[model samples]
Target: VAGQAAANQVFNSAFWVTSFLPAVTATLIAKEKAQGNEDGVQDAVCQAIFVGVFIALVTTALCFAKPNQILSSVLSQDAPAMEYARPYLLVRTFAFVPSLISLVGFSAFRGVL
Candidate 1:
């Protein structure tokens, strides 16, 4: 029960971060396309990819470095839950980059379409 709860907390946090990727990417792409700047569109997509990957890398490092502090702040005072969440959080952080990139790609496609 504790572990599952912890995992859910970690997943939810990461999901929140990823959820904005599509909106951001879509906005960037649309703005660039509206200006009729082909280069701008490419630049926006590239920037999105780079920024997403950078964010993921930073997030992963932070979670791995300070899992206890992060989990503690977000989760309850349950030690066992925190312990279980730490590893799960660390693992989930790895998905951030790819997930963000895919979202951005989808957004770009929608903009183009």
Candidate 2:
């Protein structure tokens, strides 16, 4: 759902995703056979990627939004780290929508029916 909304905004590709399930199935099936997963590896990859991206976004925000003093005490003494993290977090937050689309679109194709 999130992917669908974001894709609609970023490109008119949501319709294409909906229509592209058969190709997705063919590719995923080949991958699954290669990987030896009878249980559907595509769903597993999608869920894992979603969780990974979510964790990354959360960690980025936590480090960036909190104070330097807290971050320093918790992570490292390098001021440069926090400085670097600030922009990184902002970019990651903004990137959520696009990354979300790619992640979700690939996963969505598996269960598209």
Candidate 3:
């Protein structure tokens, strides 16, 4: 569970930061709507999604490439938990993108609404 916790911390930090994307998207969409530009609204959503995806991809890559480094930083290298955390984090990387995308989708939905 330590590993998952560590991974979640990373994800949560990301969630907090990217959480602004939806608001920005919504604001942009509203502005576009006021200007009568449908394409701009689509562009805003696409841009927000792209940013979210990009961050997720980078995070996934980092987790995949350096699970040890990550866990070591969050947890002591000599800790017994490191062994389990490493493998768990590696496996957990798979969910990163989808998790972030879903968040973006939810936020975007709210924005659009």
Residue 98, candidate 3: how far off, in angstroms? Answer: 1.2
Show how many residue pairs clash in every candidate, following the order shown: 0, 0, 0
Give the lowest summed-lDDT range of ten residues in model 3: 6-15
State the local distance difference test value for candidate 3.
Answer: 0.75
Q: Which candidate leads the pack in TM-score?
A: 3
Which tens-of-lDDT digit does each residue in 1-113 have in candidate 1?
67657766766676677677778888888988999999999998898788777877787788788877777766766676776777777777677777777777898887765
Pairs of residues at least 3 apart in sequence or in different chains that clash in candidate 3: none
Per lDDT, the best of the predicted structures is: 1
* lDDT, residue 18, model 3: 67
| Candidate 3 C-alpha error for residue 68, in Å | 1.0
RMSD of 1: 2.2
**Candidate 1 global TM-score:** 0.80
lDDT of 2 by residue, 11-81 (tens): 23322333343355446655775677767766644655555456546644554566343334433546445
Model 1 stretches astray by more than 4 angstroms: 76-78
RMSD of 3: 2.0
| Residue ranges of candidate 3 with Cα displaced over 4 Å | none
